[model samples]
Target: EGSEGFSDLPCERYHLPRPMGRLGKFILPNLLLPRALSDRIGAELLHVVTPYGCAFPTLPVPQVVTIHDLSPLTFPQGSSWMQRAHFHRLLPLILRRSRAIVTHTTRVAEALSRRFPGIGGRVHVIPPGIPSLPIPAGAVPAGRPFALHVGTTEPRKGLEILLDAFREFPLDLYLVGEILDRAELEREIERRGLGGRVRLLGFLPDAQLARLYRAATFLVVASRCEGFGFPPLEAMRAGLPVVASPASAALREVLGPAVLWAPGSDAAALQEGMRRMLQSRETREHFIAAGKAWADRYGWERFCDRIERLYHAVVSGPPRGQGSSAPMRLSQRPDAPQKETPRKREIGTA
Candidate 1:
């Protein structure tokens, strides 16, 4: 799923001309001249696992890049000035030079294509598989049922709407992950008088998180947008049901009927979704079965195998300029043998 891979395969190494500065990383095509390096090392291909929004300068070998999300571009205020500048100045150039682009969801693929036309054919959608979670060590349940929320405390994540909807409920609300918008979140909690009910358990280890996932009633993701809905999918993997607030197309297409979908992101709709999960045992059971089965399809073995095939296609397909113009769909599974993967598999990109 990332570029810091192919370590297990045999490879040669070379010394760069100079160490790159922070900004120099995004503009490496100018400073580092990777094309000259690749030529010297006999490299056949180059992969940027997390290029963010930078560097697709003309290169000797075909380049493949991974883009996590476009949240920074979509919500400019949420990101720093440096990020905005990089995306605006470099991303388009990077996209044009690359042989192919890899993304986690079709929603992102659609957004990328819509934002910058003529690149849809080069974008490949692949929902990455999760790594192994920490061993469960019970700490969150504390003898009370709670709704779990993971990731950052950004406004677009729909935390405000989730609190307004669930604050009146009898259960507790535990938010895990970093607190990016603390002032805003604190203000919301104060206004609602949810001092005791809402707990901001910031940055807990995965062991603690795994415990909460297993014991929670259900996972609620009221996000306005997501590249890949990890919490909901992981909750499903834990045999826990999920309720997504108008689950984005990326999630809907991947999750299918495995999650209970709220028609909107309003308090009323999310409240009703929670009500269904708490009151109806059948609803819980249905999503649990469907969710687990859906989650199983994203095992690391499958992701690695599929991505490897994509690499083989790129390496063997055509010259740097001319390759297949057809779009690739991930819904169909390949009948290839599974390879044991750790972190990322080593491939002969060079």
Candidate 2:
């Protein structure tokens, strides 16, 4: 499964010019400008893999990009006007120019195809692999039994609903992520008298997160939408059952039957779901087994194989036509290699 761009060792650093935050990112030393400069220095194909979708560079070389989500457009309330305007100006152009486009989940691929019909055949679903971190012996967060919530305190995360749900139960609510909507969260914390019970442990490293996951009763995701839900999958890898909102198509698709789905992104639904999980040990264990088995199906090795193939195809193929072309749908590689190799197909993207 090895390839030129696929390195298992620690990544070598590239000290590209850092762009200033916000609107300044579109000017000199912009997000893509450093990438263009890097392209000139290196023979690597530009792969805009991050959630920041507007970073596709203007270069002579072949390019591939991963559009994780369209949250800025679909859920505009969570994004700023500058972000909305930036996406509007650059997203379509980036999609059109990219040699291959990847989405984190099939849900995202379908959504993107609908939103940008021109990008139909180019889109491919490539769910991110769960990091296989060794669980080291460490102190779990010393507290009462808590329901863990991981992610930034954004409106889309539905922290309000989570806090509201916490009022119904005695279980402590432990939130670990950057506090973006601090004032809004604090107000609810105060109003609900959850000062001590609700712990906002901001930005824990992976080691610390592992500890927190071990200590938690279950993972709770109240997000209104997601490109690909990582927390539930991560929790499953740790043999932890999940209580998640089903509003996100990506989350629903990724988690499948692994998570104990909350009926909606509301306080009542979340409370009911958590109550069920807390009340029944059998249910939790069943989900835990299912989750672990489900998580095993995805790994970095498989993702790398697919990505490596895409890079090779893009470099070898001619410039794409405007019309739709068949995607390079990769099948699951066998545990052992066969004597006769399968024929590689002509996959084009525009």
Question: Candidates' lDDT values, in order?
Answer: 0.74, 0.76
List TM-scores for all candidates, in order: 0.81, 0.85
List residue ranges in candidate 1 displaced over 4 A.
1-42, 53-58, 135-141, 320-350
> Per-residue lDDT for 131-185 in model 1, tens only?
4455575444468788888878876687888899876887789899889867778
Q: How much is the lDDT of residue 110 in candidate 1?
A: 86
Q: How well does candidate 1 match the true structure in TM-score terms?
A: 0.81
lDDT per residue for candidate 2 within 155-227, as digits (tens), equals 8888888888988797998899999867778888999988889888899888788887788999999998898
Off by over 4 Å in 2: 1-12, 27-40, 51-57, 138-142, 322-350
In angstroms, give how far residue 20 of model 1 lies from its true place.
9.1
> Which consecutive 10 residues in model 1 have the weakest lDDT in total?
341-350
lDDT of 2 at 140: 59
